[model samples]
Target: MEFGAVSDEMEVKAPAAEAWKVYSTLQLAKLVVEMRPDLVEKFEVVEGDGGVGTILKLSFPASTPVFTYSKEKFTVVDEEKRVKEAEVIEGGYLNLGFTLFRVRFEIIEKDEITCITKTTIEYEVKEESAANASFVSTQTFVEIMNAVATYLTTKQL
Candidate 1:
């Protein structure tokens, strides 16, 4: 039933800021862009403070089989814990079934040298959209998480 949401969590041996830098970098978008290279032609810069209001156009490839969206607006930026996030909202067509589906990555420090990144996705699929059979949501999420793990483990930052 949870075909729309793919989430994973990973622990890192680096400071939050260290890992944050990589995730916050503009290059990070390319990882996801590989899945939908046609969708995100590039990053749309906004706010200018390296925060908020940035949007990416996600596009599907011409050679793909499934009729998927070429673009979805996923984002990376600093956010306060428990403080409601206003930017980087998701929904529209990936709406699952409801008008308010969302995906988010939250990072928290466990200590001076440890941090955990939690990926949360809320997908409210209606009966019409819930009829799909093959599902790789969780696996996709795990892959994303592993990417972060790999990035964080590459160095002892």
Candidate 2:
């Protein structure tokens, strides 16, 4: 197996607690789908709440060349650290030979009124399908960060 990871960070003009309120709950998922309908067709809750063990089924538009849907379970939700991790349990990268695919979001405080949204993508793929690892990218996370930051900043005003 081959493991790979990629990360990206975005600075937001909002408090860490404010950012965590969204990242640590299903609000972030709903915001993403509402803000970017072109990227996500649907966001459904399969089980659990917004805490650890929560399962989310995300569907992409038919125009998406890759897999149309993915089921991810929140494996980690550390309120103190303002970190959340979700692991893809079905579809998505799994169908592409990836044995593991996890996305981690960390809200780090920069100051009382500034914070950084860090996103990390970790995946393991069969050695023969190592080429599939290239599909993993932090671009989508960056987009989410942008949307969230804009939403939070405007909502505060």
Candidate 3:
């Protein structure tokens, strides 16, 4: 198997707590679907309630050339540390021969009124299908972060 990881961070003009309120819950998925319909076509909760063990299904627009849907389960949700992790259990990269695909979000406190949104993608693919790893990128997460930051800052105004 081949393992790979990518991460990116964005400075947000909002408190860590405020950012956590969205990142730690399904609100982030909702925001992404609402803000980027071209990227996410639908968001649905398959099980649990926005917490650890929760499963979410995301559908991509038809224009997307890759997988159409993905199901991810929340493996970790740490409010104290402001970190959350979701592992893709089906579809998405898994269909492309990836053995594991996980996304992690960290909201770090920069100050009383500012915070950093860190996003990471970690994956393992079979050596025979290592080429599929190229599809993994942090660009989508960066776009989501931008939308969330813009929403949070605007709401604070």
Q: Model 1 residue 106 lDDT? A: 68
| Per-residue alpha-carbon lDDT of candidate 1 for residues 1-157, written as tens digits (9 for 90 to 100) | 3345556677877777666665565455665564334433334433343344455444445553444442344344554451112222443344334433455666678888788877666555556666542332455445655666676677554
Misplaced by over 4 Å in model 1 are 1-7, 31-50, 60-70, 74-78, 82-98, 133-136
Tens digit of per-residue lDDT, candidate 3, span 1-157: 9999999999999999999999999999999999998888998899999999999999999998989999999999999999999999999999999999999999999999999999999999999999999999999899999999999999998
- What candidate 2 gets wrong by more than 4 Å, as runs, is none
lDDT (C-alpha, whole model) for all candidates: 0.52, 0.95, 0.95
lDDT of 1: 0.52
- Give the higher-lDDT candidate: 1 or 2: 2
Candidate that scores best on lDDT: 3
Model 2 C-alpha lDDT per residue in residues 1-157, reported as the tens digit of each score: 9998999998999999999999999999999999977677789999999999999999999988889999999999999999999999999999999999999999999999999999999999999999988899998889889999999999999
Model 1: how far residue 52 lies from native, Å: 2.5
By summed lDDT, the worst window of 10 consecutive residues in model 2 runs over: 34-43
How high is each candidate's TM-score?
0.62, 0.98, 0.98
